[model samples]
Target chain A: MSIVRRLGLTFGLPIILLAAWWFASANSTDFFFPPLSEILTALKDEWFGPRLLADVVPSVLRLLAGYAVAVVVAVTLGVVIGTSRTVRATLEPVLEFFRAIPPPVLVPIFLLLFGIGDGMKIIVIAFGCMWPILLNTVEGVRAVDSVLSDTARTYRITGTARLRTLVLPAASPQIYAGLRQGLSVAIILMVISELFAASNGLGFAVVQAQRSFAIAETWAGMLMLGLLGFLLAMLFKLVENRQLAWYHGLRRAQRSS
Target chain B: MLDVRGIKKVYEGKGRTVEAVRDLTFTVDQGEMVCIVGPSGSGKTTLLKIMSGLLDPTAGEVLIEGKKVDGPPPGMAVVFQEYGRSLFPWMTVRENVELPLKQKKLPNARRKELVDESLSAVGLAEAHTAYPWQLSGGMQQRVAIARAVAYEPQVLLMDEPFAAVDAQTRADLEDLIRDIWHRFQVTTLFVTHDIDEAVYLGQRVLILSSSPTVVRQDLAIDLPDERDQLNTRSSPRFAELRAQVYSQIHRPKADAAEPVGAGATAVDGGASGYGAAPDLP
Candidate 1:
């Protein structure tokens, strides 16, 4: 019975939200406050109609490029730092200090260093996406069972072979967790970067519409960004599910116990 | 053959020092199986760790075939008490068994053959592709055993390898170890706290005194080489040996009123024999 109610809640909650918004905005006087229906119409007619693919493609490409770079750099460094006690000890404070600083706050510095371009935005996104991945990778590698390490040593598995065969696989669940978190941050920073400085992308489109007081168009752009974030998060979940099927099974078993 | 002489281990921490084992000595002849038993914290594990070259004794040396064991020797393999962690979860059972063979740089074909044979020897042929987490505790321990055997080491060291399993499984594993030891003729040094397990599986049992341990008694099992779990354990000889080892381990020290028997006298006569029984208050 609880399961059935949960299912209803999952399906019904969103509809209720849309209904409430639609009713509230039905009699609004402010031009900035567009109805949900108006926003949807603008989204369908302008955002997803003829120029749909072109507007979304560049933003997605930038996000992917930044995300890929973040994953590679963060994972490599994270593994190194995690595997060596001395390295971890030397670098952990620096990493924590950097992680505490918000990436958006670096926009002015990045603009100064790299200039106002896609390069700046990419750098920002990469920087934003890196911390979660790096921290999680370190944790994952450290959390690898000591007994497995002993077994590997007993087999005389050392150096690259040990890292490749034992450490990587053992640390994958945590690494994947890091990747998911990093990807989410990447999406957030991608929009944030574009909103702050970029000439193109969804953030630029939203800002442009808002300056002209094209409220519906502004809402449509915001809606698209929200949808993109949701979609990317869902995509990450799919990847995580496929990659961490065994981890999920183990979790289920643990929960049952 | 493996020889450990005057092995002493002292652990110093937080301004306090623990003498885990002191002046312990023992030897395992080629193809002979020996079991070391003592109370918890009596350094049974520390002794095994030193023997396997996982730890260096604070004083003394472990020699395998007359060569000093400074690090994990290629000729010796170890099975730990925690079966769940010993076998790599990411690798299939066959892969786990074959890993050492790979390290030995054996040909792929020979590695495959050894893995198959070892898995079958441990009754895990069908479980070759199963991950360690997919199997029962006993089966996982069997994979660990299979891994050790597949390495084809000259000596196998087990530290309470069956302690995590159920009674039925523990008995089965004890028999399995004996069978494998006999079949392969590999020198095996098994350490356990269970007296019955030590007597059941060992050609000779070396009982150690408590902390700062030393050998209390070295009892040779008179049981036949060929053993069945039921028949051997049910025999009168098995009971006598078990009782003998039990008494040696549990004898009260302050109550010196009882006239010391030959066995008691042997344990008490020499500082070398009884040393200091584990510091069990």
Candidate 2:
């Protein structure tokens, strides 16, 4: 389909749903179903107000910190494990066990150990997101073309140059996939950690609003969280595009002919 | 410029040991282009890898400019057959060519000049900013050659570099290598299974026996240096040289050196009427 029609098809359903919700909920008296207009007002006042400073900012910061930690640890460990057979074989089983456990299940353990502070929450988020990045990076590194490795050796590209120019770029496509997967996992763990025990954060605000029966405020918090996730994803995609422009170009050229 | 002294390679396969190369010894003088041709399983790659220090021989050693080669020697570059796998797909043409220059610690200005010079030599000046996968098969191979040439190695090793491309592209690449070889005055050891290519592109053609390989013949190519796709290949001397190389590659081997193991598929070809192996002395 043409790009314009494709865009229309993509956005058409969401626009229609928003229009229906606005019209249907315009005059509703239901306690649970607040009017869309009232929801928007609450979103502006609550999300765009001091609450954003007190909640959303901290939450975003925690997510970024945790995600950054996961990336660093996973990439470093992945390269080590991927390149060395002995290391991989030794740690494979234990790493698998850790990866198999769901991130949410570790929340209580972290809460007990770190005591419900930002430290505990950030650790939980990092632990949850690290597995995919680690495994994918290992896969990418192991899958690096043998010929390219030989080329590096022949060129005498030793030390940091070997890692920076040859190994990293060669495995970057798989690494990017891992990063995207880790982002979603980080976001999930972010909310779960905050929801269990947290004074501030979007998740905690939503839970607090629901408990206090401020339904419109709860909707606003949910709306803000959804938008945050969407924006973060879009931002990740932009970075991916910039970092992997050559990879995408190659894929597109391959697809075209 | 390069010497391989009594090299032997024994691969320890699962539950068996296979001798790939045996007592292979040869030399290529400075500024000479030599091609090694053999039957499919004759261990040409093993020999090249050993010579380039990518692999160690079970016995013997290689010397480049009289220096013992235990690792990739400083003044050598190799162009492998699998261009798809050899060139970094993520890097642009310029970056791929520039990689080794950077490794060599050339200043940025000098590296840029060499990259540009080599790319244009390979007719890829317009493609410096393009990725390998964005180019055609032949173009990718050109990038590989440009990379090797850009590094300005004293000895260039190419292992069946044109075996993957179509016939037409292969011809263009053969000429490209010849042009670069002449322009740079670099000693080249090119490996190929194609008899015509071996005869057409080399100053000397080294023929190897089948498995447990040994050098069977080292024939000087007496063709004029100025060669073209039409005239050089169609020359009477070209036909005779190709057939002679063809028969040596196909000659029956002793029972002990029988073609075997992984490269067995390439054992049988050139069965059509060709000259018999030159009277063995």
Candidate 3:
């Protein structure tokens, strides 16, 4: 498909809906349901200049830091637990107990423990994202093909070489599945964590607008959050396609054949 | 050189005990191609696994170059039947072939030469950049062969490597194996269920029995070294030798007392002795 057609297919409905809102709300007088034009103007006036650096940059950095820590910690622990039957058996119930508890509940506890700062929010984000990637990595490592394992063994591909060549790549597709799930979860928890006792962030800005009754600014903040989510999702898809090109191609070939 | 001495394997499950391989013994000397053929469920795979050090035997051991094989000795390489699963899908053909050499810690120049030579030897130099899944079944199997060949091991083990490909591809791969064996002079121990494949590939064919699996007949294939799919397979000698192996596979253990006929296993019409007759006076 051509780039124009693909873009039209993707954005056509959203554009139409935005246009409808633009025309429909042109003369809106309700405080909560402000005009789209007013919201756009409010978005630029409130967030486009000073807040972009002070609020948005810091929020994005914290999200990424938490996400990176979660990925590294989870994958490391998952490979260990998955590769060994004893470790998996020993930790499975404990992990299950922890995983059953809702992630949001930890935020207030984290607040009490770490106090209101970047540390608490980062921990909350990491804790929320850890479950999916960790479990998927464990599952993926466990499900590495027996033939491939045997081939690795017979070739004397041991230690780091075996892990690098066989274990990681073999389990990567499933790992990516977990990673993808964790990303949206991380985004959600980032906002949720920011909502409580956060002095600066996109979430803080939105809640702040709501508290002071700046209705159009509040709507504009929500729009920015949605736009941020969409852009981040697109960025994630580009990385995944690059990292797992071979996997996608392999599946496509298998499916067609 | 490889020696499989008195290998026995028994599976102790939750409810039952099953004997997979019982007192199996064989030897494949350096630069020799020996094929092991057995009936279905005869533990051919179990024996290969034991020899390759991928699995442990209840008794006995495998020795390569006089060193015992306990944990997949560095001197050995295996070409598995499931080519799709054996070759890493994430890596291109060149990467798959170069992986073992990386383990061996060879220099980049040496590694590249080995990978290039092996790929071309298997008629797959052009497909070096292609991933295993991008190729046909036969081509995938060729990549597996190239990987094994690049390892430059003393003993090469193949467990029905051509079983997944079509007949024509099977024939072509069989020739490829022979060519590699001739070129590299790597000691190859092949295990297969196909009788004709066994007869065609090996200098010596070992027929294995079912149940408590044991060697039934250690027949010697007396065809010319420069054999082809058409000429050698159509030869009378190949037919006679193939028939002997076929009957031996079907024969039960209870009728083991009768000695094989004078011309049963080798049927050497060309020479007096060609390494087939073991109990000759």
Candidate 4:
């Protein structure tokens, strides 16, 4: 597809939805449902200034720290698990059990251990976000083609060189799939973690606006969070495109021929 | 300088025991190109795997220069049949070719030089930046050849490397292999189901019987040094050699290498009959 057409496909629905929301709430009188103009005004007043720095910076940093931890730990563990049948058999069921527990449920458990500090919130995000990436990495590593592995072996490309040139690149497509899933999980956990016994963050700000009945500001905070999530996803997609160019190109070549 | 000493492979899996290769033995001399031919289900791949140290034989061993190969030897390289899967799709043609050289720990200048020379040798000089998947099947196989060539191994092993490409491409690759074999003088073991390919590229063709497989005949190719796609293939000698190999594969499984070919006459319209085995059966 042409870039213009792809851009149209991506942005077309959101533009229409935003326009619909603008007119639908234009004459609203309910306190919960405010005018779009009021929400925009609230957005500017609430976050387009000093508060943006004080709250958003810390929230984003926490999200990043937790996400980095998740990615590193998951991929490392995933490779170990993927490479060995014994390890996979022993740990997979336990990992699946943990995965089934909703991440929000763990926020309380982490809070009990760490208390309501940055550590608790960070752990909450990290623990919540690790599953998808971990599982995907295992699947990817396990699925590395046998012919490629044989070629590597016969050529004596062993140890770290084998890992870097063969295993990692072969498993990256699926790892990226996991990373994408984990991103959304991290964002959600970031908000939910702040909602419990937290004084400042994107989630805290939203709750504060709600408790004090700053309805428009509360709506604005949510709008900002959604937009933030959208922006992060777009950034991730950019990186994925650059990284998996070969995979995509291969698929294209295969399909056309 | 490669030896298969009493190699046997039995695949025991899924409540069944299948003997893939049964007591096979052969040898390839230094700087010689030998092709192994057999019908389907003849355990050709299993034998190659055992020889290449990718898989262990149930009994026996492969030796390079009289040393037992317990693992993939540092002085050998393999070009697999599935060129699509064998070449790393994530790497460009140059990167794929240079990877094994890097493993060999050659310095940067020499590595680049070998990669460049090998790529050009296989007619892939202009495809350095292209990914393996972006190239045609033949081009991808050339990249694989370039990789094996760049490794500069004492021995090179290929398993049906041209099975996937079109006929035209296959002919080109066959010539390329013979050209590389002559120039570098790397002892090569080429395995293929195609009798014509085996006859064309090999100095000697090792004809294998059906599973449980064994060497049926070790026939030396008597074609001239100068060979081409058109003239060499149409030669009566080429037809005669291929006919012998073709017949050998179709015959009932033989438990031992046969002592034949001495009394056989050359094909029709040929004055110079081929000689008997230069080495013992």
Candidate 5:
């Protein structure tokens, strides 16, 4: 599709959604079913208010910290396990076992250990995010073309130099793919952890507003969380595009032909 | 210089051991261009890999300048058939060419000069900043060639480097390789299944027999050293050399129904047709 047509299609769905939401709430009598206008007012009030900023800042900080930790640990472990058959064999089963366990299921355990503080939330987010990045990294490293590796070897490139120049760069596109996947997971777990146990953050605000029967306030919180996730994802995509510019160009050329 | 003596390769698969190469022996002198040609499954690639130090021979040793080659040698470089995979997609042409120079620890100025010279020689100076995927198949192969040449290795091994390109591009690449070979005077060993390419590119071509391969005949190209695709292909000598290789390759299969001695005689006569050229040391 043309760029303009794609843009129209994107806006088309949101327009339909807004219309449905407006129509449904217009005839409702319950105070919980506020109109779209009231919900918008609440969103503006909450977003522009001090409480909203405070919650956003803490939530963003935790997310960033968890993501950074996940990236470092997963990439390091992925490279080691990916390149060594013995390490992969020994760790595969254990990694699979851990990966299959849902991050929310471990919240009680983390809560006990870290005591329901920011530490517990961060740990939960990190645990949830690490798998995709680690597995993708392993696939990326293993997917490096053998011929390129041989060429590097032929040029006397070995050890750390080989990893840095050949293996890592060759594997980066896939690693970035993993990062994108991991980032989405991290966002989901961040909200889940905060909603389930946190005293602050957007998720906690949503739960608080819901309990108070302030439907507009709850809708505003949900809207803010959705916007945050979208923005974070967009930011990650921007970084990925910059980092993988060459790979994207190649893909474009491949598709065009 | 490279010497391969009693080289053997046996691949163990499932429950059987398949002999890929057996007791192969040959030597390439300094500054010589030697081509190895054989039918499919005749282990030409296996021998090239062993010679290039990419693979170890099961029974014998490969020596470069009288030194045993147990691994990739410092003075040797290889250009593989799949140029697309051999060149890093993430690296620009200049960076790809400069990588080996970096490995050699060459000074930046020297490395830059060598890279520029090699790229210019291959007519890719304008493409220095372009990534491999941005170039055509033949252009990518040129980058691969430029990379190997920029390394300034004492010996270069190419395994059917032009096999993946179009006929026109293959011709251009062939000429480019010949020009580089002449200019650099680096000892080159080229392996190809194409008889014409083998005769056209090499000063000498080694024909190998069928499975459990051995050198059947080593023929020297008596045609003038300078070559052009149109002029050389039109030459009577080129046709005679190609015809001789064809007979050698097809002789065993065609004579299979003949008496054993008769088939052997046909093979001997075919070998002698191209073997009349003066030998290299």
Candidate 6:
């Protein structure tokens, strides 16, 4: 009963919101607040047309490239810093200071260095996303169960085999937590970085349409961004479900009566 | 097969020092089954860690087959007390058992044979693919045992492996371990606080004193080689040996207060020659 009802409640809110929007704007004639039907049509034409190849593809590729770079760098450095006290002490405060400064505030600095190109925007997204992953990985690596570590040592499981089988899997739950958080930040920065600088992207498309008073296209772009966020979240969930099945099973068992 | 010569461990940290083990010295002969019994916090664990080469001693050294140990000796495996934490939660039972074998660089065929045989020995054949967290505490301990058995180490160190389970399950696991030990003929060092368990399982029981611990007594168990949960425990000889071990662990310096054969807790059959006036014999 709980499972079925909760699932029902999940889809219930989204359906209700869509229904309200469709009805409230269906009869309106305002140029700014266009009808939901017209907005949906524009969303389809704008996204599913040639504009997709130019705008959506580039935006997604930048986001993915940035996220990939962040995942690798953060996980590698996190493990190093987490395992070594000297490195952690030397670098942690600086990382904290960097993380504290809002990512959007760094756009001007990135633009100054990398120019108004894909490289600058990509680096900004990577920088914004890297912190959660790095911090969580560090905490996770440090908190690996001492007994498990001792077990590996007693078995003479050293070097890469030790890291791959023992350290990485033990720290994965926390790492995934950080990855999910970083994904959200990545998405936000993907849009924010382009808002001030980019020639093409979902954020650019929306801003450009608004300035030209193509209000329907602006709404359509907003809708597309929302869809992209939803789809990315779903994609992450799929990967996490496959990768973290054991953790999920454990959690489910823990929660079961 | 294993030798511990004057091993002492002093943990120094943050301007504080703890002498966990003090001059603990003993030798476990090849194929010997010994149990070390101590009061809680008597540093039985610290001693075991030193023997297993997981910790360096403050003074002396552990020698495995005449090789001085600085790190985990290549020929040793340990089943820790915290089964929940010791078993890798991310790995399946088979994977956990195979991990050490992979470290040994055993051929794939030999690794599979050992894992299969060891799992069956501990009755976990169907649980090959199951994660450690999915199993019951008793079963998890069995997996740990299977893992140690699969490693085929020269010396197997078990630190209160059954302490986390129910009484009935603990009894069953005790029998399982004894069976594994006999079949494999690997030297074993089992640590526990339960006197009955120590007496029932070990060929020689090493009693340990309280904090800053030392070996108090080393009593040879003189029971028959064949043992069972019911007859071996209920036998008068088992009771006498149990009484002897209990006295050694609890009343080490107070031996003159009561006859050694006087059981710590009275047995069902009283006034036996073994328990009462043995001088009449």
User: A1-257, model 3: which lDDT tens digit per residue?
Assistant: 99999999998999999999999999999888999999999889877767788788888888999999999999999999999999999999999999998899998899999999999999999999999999999999999999999999988888888899999988999899999999899989988999999999988988998999999989988888888888888998899899899999999998999
What are the clashing pairs of model 3? none
Reference-based lDDT, each prediction: 0.83, 0.87, 0.88, 0.89, 0.86, 0.87
Q: Kindly report which residue stretches of model 4 are placed more than 4 angstroms away from their true locations once superposed.
A: A1-10, B253-281
Per-residue lDDT for B49-136 in model 3, tens only? 8888888999987777667778888888899999999999999999999998988889999999999999999999799899899999
- Give the backbone clash total of model 1: 3
lDDT of 5 by residue, B135-227 (tens): 999999999999999999899999889989999999999999899999999999898999999999988888877667767666778889989
**lDDT comparison, 1 vs 5, better candidate:** 5
Clashing residue pairs for model 2: none
Residue A140, model 4: Cα distance from true site in angstroms: 0.2
Per model, kept true contacts as a fraction are 0.40, 0.90, 0.96, 0.98, 0.79, 0.83
DockQ for each of the predicted structures, in order?
0.46, 0.66, 0.80, 0.81, 0.63, 0.62
lDDT of 4 by residue, A110-188 (tens): 8899999999999999999999999999999999999999999998888889889999999999999999999999999
Question: Which pairs, if any, clash in model 1?
Answer: B210-B277, B210-B278, B211-B278
Q: Is candidate 1 or candidate 2 better by DockQ?
A: 2
Per-residue C-alpha lDDT of model 6 across residues A1-257, encoded as one tens digit per residue: 69889988899899999999999999989988999999888888877776698889999999999999999999999999988999999998999999999999899999999999999999999999999999999999999899999999999998899889988888899999999999999999999988987889988888888999988888999888898999999999999999999888878766772
Fraction of native contacts in model 3? 0.96
Error of 4 at A51 (Å): 2.3
Q: How close is every model to the real structure, measured as TM-score?
A: 0.89, 0.92, 0.95, 0.94, 0.92, 0.93
Candidate 4 lDDT at A53 equals: 89
lDDT by residue for model 1 (A1-257), tens: 69989989877988898899999998787888977889989999878965466567778888999999999999899899998999999998898899999999998899999998889989999999999999999998898888788777767788888888888888989899889888888888877787776767776777777899889988888888888888888888898787677677556644664
DockQ score of the complex predicted as candidate 1? 0.46
Model 6 TM: 0.93
Residue-level lDDT tens digits of model 2 in A150-257: 989999988899899888887899999999999999998898898887999988988999999999999888888889999999999999999999888877877887
Query: For model 2, how many clashes?
Result: 0
lDDT of 3 at B44: 90
TM-score of 2: 0.92
DockQ leaderboard ranking: 4, 3, 2, 5, 6, 1
Better of 3 and 5 by DockQ: 3
Error of 1 at A32 (Å): 2.2
